[model samples]
Target: MKIIAKNKVAYYDYEILETFEAGISLMGWEVKSIRANKVNLKNSFAYFKDLELYWSNAHISLYMAVKGDEQRTRKLLMHKSELKKIHFKKTTNRLTLIPLSLYWKQGKIKLELALAKGKTKYDKRQSEKAKEEKRKIEKMLKNYS
Candidate 1:
């Protein structure tokens, strides 16, 4: 898959439990802008509205001569069963849905979304420390070989 945009902050701030693929409804201009790599997934998330899913805070830079909101809410296409499943988790498990990445698959734009739980400040610090230790270990192993 060719990735157009990624939300790295989502990974750092949440503990992912499950992931799923989703299709996005987009305008022609928005598609063109995305092809040019003028998309941002930062702070973007998916929410439910009357049993349907909508994407918010994602930005697609306007194509020249196209006037519209760059961060307008967009609809996400998914199966009813999957939607119901996600909603169940959301309501009972208190998990949130977050966009992990935007990419192209089979010539169509696809969204990789994760069901996650928010991490505490301590969790963030522990992850950072673990990463640093892993990096140091990898470096030492490389030098030893």
Candidate 2:
């Protein structure tokens, strides 16, 4: 799988509970833009409407030679069971679905959806501290060896 773009901030700001892969609906120019490596998943999220999934806020730059919608709401295709489960989690568990990455799988574009809960301020601080501690440990080990 060739990853096109990744939402690095999602990892820092959310606690991921699960992940699912879903196919994306794209237009001709949108797909072309992606092939040119012009897509962003940093602030994109998925939502359910009419029992169908739609993704918004993901930016796919307009193709230079083709006039197309730059940031259209793209549909996400998933199995009925998966969609139902995600809807349930969103409603009952209060979890959010964020698009973590966009990649090509066997010539088709696929999105990796992360089932995540937003991190509190303290949780962010704790994660930062843990990362710092790990860095320090690695440095100490390197110097001692």
Candidate 3:
């Protein structure tokens, strides 16, 4: 699978509990744009309205050849049972549904969604410190080798 766009902030800001692979409903022009790697997942999230899931704030740059909105709300295709499960988790557990990455899988575009809880300030700081220490260890190993 080739990743077209990723929401890097999702990992840093949320602790993921579960992940789901979902298909996205896209316009023809949007599909073309995605194939060209003209997509953004930052500030984007999934929400349910009337029991249907929709993607909001995700940006797909318009194809020069087509006329369409760049930031339209797109539908997410998932099974009814799956949707109900997600809805249950979201409403009862207070978890969030975040789009982690957009990628091409077997010639079809797929979205990786995560069930997550927002990280606290202290958690973020701890992660940052761990990252720093990991970097230092890697650098030291590289120098030694």
Evaluated at residue 135, the lDDT of candidate 3 is 100
What are the runs in model 3 whose C-alpha is more than 4 Å off?
141-145
Winner on TM-score (1 vs 2) = 1
**Deviation in Å, model 3, residue 86 alpha carbon:** 1.0
- The predicted structure with the larger lDDT, 1 or 2, is 1
Q: How close is candidate 2 to the true structure, as a TM-score?
A: 0.96
TM-score of each: 0.97, 0.96, 0.92
Q: lDDT per residue, candidate 1, 35-120, as tens digits? A: 99999998889999999999999989999999999999999999999999999989899889999999999999999999999999
Shift in Å, residue 55, candidate 2: 0.4
Estimate candidate 2's alpha-carbon lDDT, on a 0 to 1 scale. 0.93
Ranking by TM-score: 1, 2, 3
RMSD of 1: 0.8
Residue lDDT tens for model 2, 24-113: 988988988899899988888999999899999999998877776777899999999999988998889999999999999999999999
Which candidate model has the greater TM-score, 1 or 3? 1
Residue pairs of candidate 1 with colliding backbone atoms: none
In angstroms, how far off is 134's CA in candidate 2?
Answer: 0.5
